[model samples]
Target: MSLGSRSSRRHHRALQHRAIALVVLASVLVACVFHNGASNGSPGSIPSDLEPGDVVHPSPIPGSTDQTIELARTKIKHIVFVIKENRTFDTLFGRFPGADGVTQGTTCDGKTVPLLRAPDRVGDQLHSFFDGITDINGGKMDCFAQGGYVQYLPQDIPHYWAYARRYTLADRFFSSIYGPTGIEHLWTFASQSDHFIDHERPGQFGSASREFCDDPLETALAFRSMARQEQERIYQAEDEGAQGLAQIRASLTSRWPCFDVKVLPDLLQQRGISWKDYRGENPFVQPLRMVRHVRFSSMYRNVVDVSEFMRDVKARKLPAVSWLTPSFKLSDHPPTSICAGENWFVTEMNGLMRSPYWSSTAVILTWDDFGGFYDHVPPPHVDLYGLGPRVPAIVISPWARSGFIDHDTMEFASVLRFIETIFDLPPLTSRDANTNDMLNAFDFTGRPRPPLLMRPRTCPAR
Candidate 1:
């Protein structure tokens, strides 16, 4: 071969070796990135103290050797919270003459009285329909009495006691506010009871003594507070325009950090977590759904579209937490009719829980307010503030002890606190910052929980 031809062949071989080396190096770098990301947790997974597959034994809280995560630890990955409409604990569970008797009561002299004995007007049309009767003050029969009635209202009676008795109940659950749906709903999720107070009056958000009404004025005031006080100044830019309506628009706009993302991004972003706002029909702006939708993270018009949710769960694509609001027609709120809204909600949840994903899912059922329903117990007073009215709250999970009853007084912040505890995320300001953590529900001791209650369908009493 000629000398020049030999040199050309050597140069070609060198180029070929360089190309091969580059390909191998790129492959190794890609593998390292993928492994590291997986070890930390893929996007939207619950932020846990331990990595995947790492066994976490019970770890006790500092200064208290007996208090450990194991004491209440149960395998719960997805925490689904469904907050329903108004109704008090006594209004729903008061009539049942069984274990639910825990909810029976009458307000007398700053005390609560249980209606153990049947009323004298037994067999009355309304009397026979319900297990309990409301006795008017002095047993009067006036429909509009001032001091409050001792008798029961048929609509307010929670007739699902027989079925619900099988599941756990939180008797001490209280509304964050006492008045209309909006204020209570706001507190239900945000734990902000003072935001709706008539700015004209100090220390009184709204009056629970009167029927519910929403003035555009009130909405404007509330939005203003959110703008000025939200942790992120994104809600408060005067640059959006106008003092009233324009300001409200700007607040809702994505300019505000809170409104920037479909779900809370600042806290979850660090973990590659993202949330989808599936609220349909724009429930927040709709007059009918505003109160309820504002309290939830997702507001879908068709709740029965379980397939959409099912797909995520089956694919293990479920976010660490999902907030679902019932369709307007499905919610038990007035104007919307479900014979047993609570039962319907539970039935829907049970379906999700029954899926193979049950091992890692938890569902919390609660009410937005006591709706005009009667509640016998006087809510506890804390620093001169009563935590609204008594309402029902249930926690369901494969890790929950079946038939467990939690009597501790709780607020919406308890739910937030639980989520924070689960993910070890920082608490959002407002009510969540000062709330008690619901760590008592899990069993960190390493024992598995009994199966959750699963009724096939909604059952209504004849």
Candidate 2:
């Protein structure tokens, strides 16, 4: 009990203090990393080891430089967006030359499976949001066998293949969100989905006869909680016990299918830019119908039948922007005739090419979701929602880089960014604001290429 004992005690206290300081510093650094990631609208939990193909890299500014924006606006006056049904890039163009597609896929049981030649009418497989996550299997991309593993040859969809060979084919384009038709359609119009993760459930959402706002008032759609803590909980809950998973899912929020959020059409309206939503026989595919403003107001008139698309082209009444959707039979959805879908697509493109609008029009043809098909690429995790499986996208225009294969990592928001850039419209959400503007797909200074019309082929006898 002297000076020596007192000095030893002081040294121990100092060492403990230093340990506490180091712990606090480590905590602050971890918090900063998450804050920076979430500040940019990306998932705070993104793995540091994600591949380049597994990330959505934004352009330097919002939409590149002023010169690029000016060039886009000057060269393009009209954009025809033809969104078909669920078909992954590998499902349609897996064997196409120079495309990032695969002829084989891995299964959940660690077995390789060759992609069988899919018929014009293969059976449909499960592709719900939950199913999409299961198929991804935490980026292993090996659970498509849980759904189906099939691919179509060029002969099955001659027109689509021909279009890719003649125009710009984007092999790395992903769906804005995970599967099912309705939610992806919503993402097409609005980059944000109001946190909704899936389509309306059958019994939980009333009669399920319709998926739009016109459905029964009691109907509600389930949405994931975007709260940072909730996102982390759910993200980690994937491999947890069934009871834990159920508890997490039960904590999810829900709302009516109708959303009041701002969409691209609202910006177009503000700018006095003309646009139309040309719907095919299917009523549920029309996304504008789910918006309260468009559904209950005078803007509803802009949503018309698909037949009117060609009529408007022939009459020179095509609007500045057009969204075209096809019916179930021609949607290229499984069990539907792929030939029929290709033929319908060719007919529309042919009509546009022959019209005077062809000179200034840019036609963007793409599928909505993966449609339970086998795709080799894993979708990059952007947020709690998605940058779902890779899908086929074609940019057809006189200014399009002919026969080019673009491997840029993009989603539906990229298309929105392009339209917003060309029209000088503001982005509706962070997803679109930070996405690529798709300027790489075009050559504005090069000579405008002539249209290469394709002949529709007859469907083979089943």
Candidate 3:
């Protein structure tokens, strides 16, 4: 009885052991598949050593890897992209007495031409509305002139030449795509109109039309994909490293999440890349609100309060990329007045450039979109955003040639491309991928651009 009972018990124990072994084997197989895919830089399920947003890829843009590594190495960082709200070229710089478009007339192929047309003589409807001479929209002053010989900068304005001289003004710059503040802001980053839904319907124009024009026309998206792949490759290395680490850790304390987590804060500390999404003060008119894709995702950091910027500045912490959007008071949405915005911006930038951070940084000053101000030069016909109207653009870098004017037509993608060139990072998606680069403004081979700092600016009151 003892021998028979003992044998039966041993058989039962053996079956249970086999079942446990099978379960462990299945788990290992699944983990291996995940690790392999993550190593290949596949999206969705990321690896242990990578951040959720991190992209892992094998081969990266040829120069991108080295550049990123170089950035990781230095405090002598590259771009400080400062983007402001809209103002048309004609409205802002055309009256600069020195602007060829203003005095000598913009020329092409040996012929002189006007850079922009004045708004159609403010239609009776608009002038009447603005003057409060007529009752419209319940006397709230719906003063916008949808048609007119728009107002031009008064010829007597001062400092127009100084602003141009101190900055790399792009007289022919164009908003990459059309529509309102939201769609154009996306162009600043992704350069893809993926969020746009409307295609060829004619009536939808401006911001509404653009928000609906979803298409990826930039190269940055491709790079993002590639960067993701490279990140995967790095994780593959890290995974291999983690396995070695885990085996070591397992031999000591019980395995916990802390030992396995690849924290972004830690990674950023190691890499020396600092990032923050500054939304300035106001939400109602903040460019971020207009970004359709952002609303659909948690991509944008909602509160980029001015207090944060002030705190960072006080701490003397100028990050590699300082993206600041002015608060509602600062954003150039109409009825708020344009002069106040320009004055505030010029003051803010002037102060920053004067700070110690100016030595190694290239501060980029640009308008987010043309504020529906009339620009004389028509944009080039491109199938991408489908010929958006012309907008003024300016690039002010410590490395930029002073008093320079670039007549080349530029788009928002051009800004990203400039960032890519200066920082040696790869481009993002869509039009940004194929768009013009801002390299023409600076000769990096030379001295950090000669100091061309100018006084705070203010556009004329409307």
Candidate 1 per-residue lDDT, tens place, 1-462, comes to 998999999999999899867754643342222211211112232111111121123222222133444333235566776666655566455554322234334443435544332221212111100001121111111111122223333333343443344445676676654334444444444444333321221112223221122332223222233422331232122111122224333433111111111122235555655432223221321222223333243432323243456566667676766655565444555434445555566566666766776777677777766554455554432211124456777776666655666554566666765765666666554345444455554444554554445453433433
Q: How would you encode candidate 3's per-residue C-alpha lDDT over 131-173 as one tens digit per residue? A: 1111111111122234322445553223333555666777656
The lDDT for every candidate, in the order shown, is 0.43, 0.76, 0.45
| True lDDT of residue 243, candidate 2 | 25
Ranking by lDDT: 2, 3, 1
> For residues 22-98, what per-residue lDDT tens digits would candidate 2 score against the true structure?
75464334223321142222234553221112123433543356787688788899998889987999999999997
The weakest ten consecutive residues by lDDT in model 3 span 127-136
Worst 10 residues of 1 by lDDT: 124-133
Poorly placed runs, candidate 1 (over 4 Å): 1-67, 70-74, 95-167, 197-266, 274-307, 335-340, 382-386, 444-447, 450-462
Q: What would the TM-score be for candidate 3 when compared with the true structure?
A: 0.55
